[model samples]
Target: MTLLALKNISLRFGGPPLLDGVNFAIERGERVCLLGRNGEGKSTLMRIVTGQQQADDGDVMRSQGLRIAEMPQDVPKGLSGTVREVIASGGGKVGAALAEYHHLLHENPDDLDRLGSLQQILDTQNGWALDARIDALVAKLDLPADTDFNALSGGLKRRALLGRALALEPELLLLDEPTNHLDLDSIAWIENFLADWDGALLFITHDRSFLRRLATRIAELDRGQLTSWPGDYDNYLRRREERLHAEAQEVALFDKKLAQEEAWIRKGIEARRTRDMGRVKRLYEMREQYAQRRNLQGTAQFTVQDAERSGKLVAEAKNLSYAAGGKTIARNFSTTVLRGDKIGIIGPNGVGKTTLLRLLLGQLHADSGEVRTGSNLEIAWFDQLRSTLDERKTVWENIAGGKEYVELGGARKHVMSYLQEFLFTPDRARSPTHVLSGGERSRLLLAQLFSQPANLLVLDEPTNDLDVETLDLLEELIVDFAGTVLVVSHDRAFLNNVVMRTLAFEGDGRIGEYIGGYDDWLRQRPVATARPAAGTKPKPAAVPVVATAPASKSPLDSKQKRELAELPGKIEKLEAEQEALGLKLATLYASDPGKAVETQKALSAIEQTLATAYARWESLESLRDA
Candidate 1:
């Protein structure tokens, strides 16, 4: 069944339309992701769906009595209640059911009819099993049961809020930038939870891995238009590239045809000048026809100078450390950057990825160790804050230093051509840098960086505000770059595509070097470090196994062997019944109003039976294995 639908939705914010004639729908149990660069109306669309904001002109259709829960981008300030209390405040039938369950458990009711009425509500709401669900959700988000919600860290608070949202068990869940403040462990936990969740999910996030694992479809907002592609992020990107390439070819063919026609008109005009006025008139009409058929020019080209050769050692650091706000961010850190190296710096927020970048660039001095650069190295750095550019200057002046150049056509072109490649038009190129958006500033910086020659590139969060197209261009530039690069980014896709190695910032001022991309680093990270506080000591490295014993005969005794052989069949039969019951419940709820109440009762009974069968099968299987 369709949960929500938007028809011909359009929204404007005092300027151009942010969303124009957008039509989208969310079906029950579908996980759709809203994707776009910042200020592209993703958040606006979420608000419209939740009824917090109304579209300028459109209709929103929602199922009757449908419940939706949203996690806002910013947490409310000065929240007076405890974390647990806040989580329990999700409104709707679940909240009412929980209240009734509490009343039935504690209040001694002299009226038997009222007590029985409360009991029925409790069963209908699944209130008896709510505690187990809450526990599971809290554990999945890695939140401690007794931790004070008011006193928790920012990351922990975010998790606690997400846990509360899940506890509501709403039919639709809306999460915006869910992983923005989470650590890697928390991110992994959320990924696993979303994988198993059986409700409709609509979220906006920058974590590529999370999107790839959870999203069933991708919807991208660009230039006031929404384009949806069915499948994961990888599939969307693949198809987008194919479409772009095809469009480029078509544009090229149009340009070729226009050029051929123009040439023929030029020859005809030259021949008719000496022959007849009628021929000249005809040639003029042909010239006008060819002029109107000219294709729009493509974006300007990006060219970079070959990087100069560097010494064997590109960078070196010895026992480098830094402390801020009574926290040791980097301590006793040492690494060597050799020639032709591409390294990525990754870690949780405030773990010192940016601090390390500053240390390498000599912007900050370490208290103990040394940072040494290779001989004759030229560096071009892209700062996360974009502090390198002068905000008071025009984009053209910033790139060209107030210079003008004459092209082959003898028309004077300002440095706007370079800016246009980064999506800036002629008028926008004349605007002050202070007014540029974050994404525009990022692109302008890259255009300026590539314009100049540098051997060592240091980029901090280069993918922060870039769109998919700009990111692709940057990736291509890095791959073709012959120089060394050290990038710090939280974008997994960008890191995997651009970097060859990783420098991870471990807590307590230590850094670990992982020998691959983000995925490779995840696989090796489990054994890379040990947390004694988590009640597990580091294990010794494993040796290669040369041989293993194999047995064709059953190892168990006769009685156990018979039980083990029968357990598999019993478990399979129970699983099939459980699946059938679940499907029946779904269909009944969708198609038959009369069967809805009956199906709920039947579902509860089937669930109980399935639980018993599963327990018995598990016991037999365990005994056989033992």
Candidate 2:
């Protein structure tokens, strides 16, 4: 049941090798995820595998007469028709068989053999039921069947393309970034659909949650080489770390032994003709081995500037209501935000997450509510559209604003040097913004934001197009940030690492606050109905419940339960430390300016430590009576 084999694959485009002697294979029912840094030729390898492009060296072997269908990253051009027609076209064999059967009837009504073969194909493929199946699929995917393919939104277009690819039911499915433009519901549906798929799947995507759930194996493409590990995402992470650590130790050991051998030879051991000649030759051989060894590269560096102290009452809304195009997005919503609060906004696409943010920022007037903000609040916004960047401006010009040098960390550095900090080359710095890749643009925007520290960070889909390394860096910065953050991102791993709580926008303008990340929100949602598909829940398996100490592990003691109820609010207020200190600092500023400065200093020092202290206290008290 082997689907395909790619052996000794080498692809070069007249420059550095894109893929170097790569070995890859897919068997039936294997869900493999191809991972790599941006611009590492992952897409190129896909094209080569599908025969859309050719590798300079190597062979792509497939079992004879195997069917392969691909959903490329970009929608191909010249596709003009309704969504239904396009999906039918993607039903390659069904459509082809139907055409052949009709043609045989027209060419020779007496040709029973050919007609029989065509009818058998048409019947086997369920050609007569094709339209109904496509309709159901399109409806499930929320794609408008009657709408022209080109007129659909980018996300919808991707769904349509995928629908077509799926209709074909090929032996192998190749997908690139399938979850990029999808909403949570759509992503969940795809995950469920792919789980039941019987064919082999190889895809590239930045969705860690998707990979964790569906990927049976992971292949990492780095430095023009492919390294595959058989496991899910979390398992791959642990194994890869161990593999790298082992490699480091091996290289260190070899270097140390080679150094000792070289030292012995340098001490005139080779001059002792018969006695030392063998040892001397061994030393030379060891040097050759050690010299050829390569070590793992360092990870990307990411830093966030310390934000200045802000008042505790960052921003709050009272009865916030908003409506656009005769549809309500937020209705009578009210919430308070405090300094150092990390809140994540999540909902289906176009569910007013951005509108709510704009209302809090006072960019939009709510229909019947008021927004209040502290004077000391400084906001840094990462727009989903990246409108802050000018397409006509070069990277250096966009960041530097015509200045050759910018002040960073109290030192004046050349703008080019600063641009290089984001891994942009000198030539790239001079290239217009339109030419940069999505990841590159995101990097530039982040660099600009990090350069100017702010007390409140509002990021919309900040993880979009960011590589795994940068995603890790961003998560670290958010966790360690001194300021408050309100972000909208679909990246589950990123949300889990960065946000302590989430604000989920349920349909029809109802906003609910859930404790914890995306997975936590899912847990709090209503059963299997949380996702798009209904009646698809698996039957629960029966299991015996064993009681520890004969069910003597009693309910949390009254005191512990009481503390648990109060902890969430208490932690929120504590995180907003500067706001809590506002009045005291103001009074001290009048009475003793120097004392006020010292008090302000103490507040910042204690804020983060206090949060951790409260968390530890909660954990201890929860287990105290149990």
The per-prediction CA RMSD against the true structure, in angstroms, equals: 12.2, 16.1
**TM-scores, in order shown?**
0.64, 0.75
In order, candidate lDDTs are 0.73, 0.79
- In the range 1-626, model 2's lDDT, one tens digit per residue, is 55678878998886567888887767777788999888788888999888989998999888898889988777888877677777777877676565455546656879898888877876776887765677777877888877778987666788888888887668899999888766677777888888888998999988888888898668888878787665457756876788778977887888898888766666654555445677878987887776654334345465666667899888899888899988888888899888889999988776778888888878898888888887677788898889999999999988889999977666788988887778787888999999988778899999788767687889999987877887888898888888899999878888988998898888777888888998788889765336545215766767977766654455676886787777777777666774556446534533453465466556656666666768766675657656
Which stretches of model 2 miss by more than 4 angstroms? 92-127, 250-297, 427-430, 526-626
- For candidate 1, give the lDDT: 0.73
Error of 1 at 183 (Å): 4.2
Give the per-residue lDDT of model 1 (tens digit) for 1-626.
77888878999987568888887777777788998865678989999999999999989989998889987766767553445445555534655555444444556556677667767776776765765676666655556655557778766788877877777778999998787556566666677777777989999876677788898767777757676665468867876677669967986776686666556556766664666566556656755765544233343356455456778788889988889889898888888898779999988765777788878767788888899978867788888768878989998777877786413223454576667766787888889998986667877888777666677888887775565556777788888888899998777888889898899877788788889888778777755463322212457769998787864544567886686677677767766765565456434432452354454456556567767767866766665565
TM-score of 1: 0.64
Clashing pairs in 2: 312-579
- Winning model by TM-score: 2
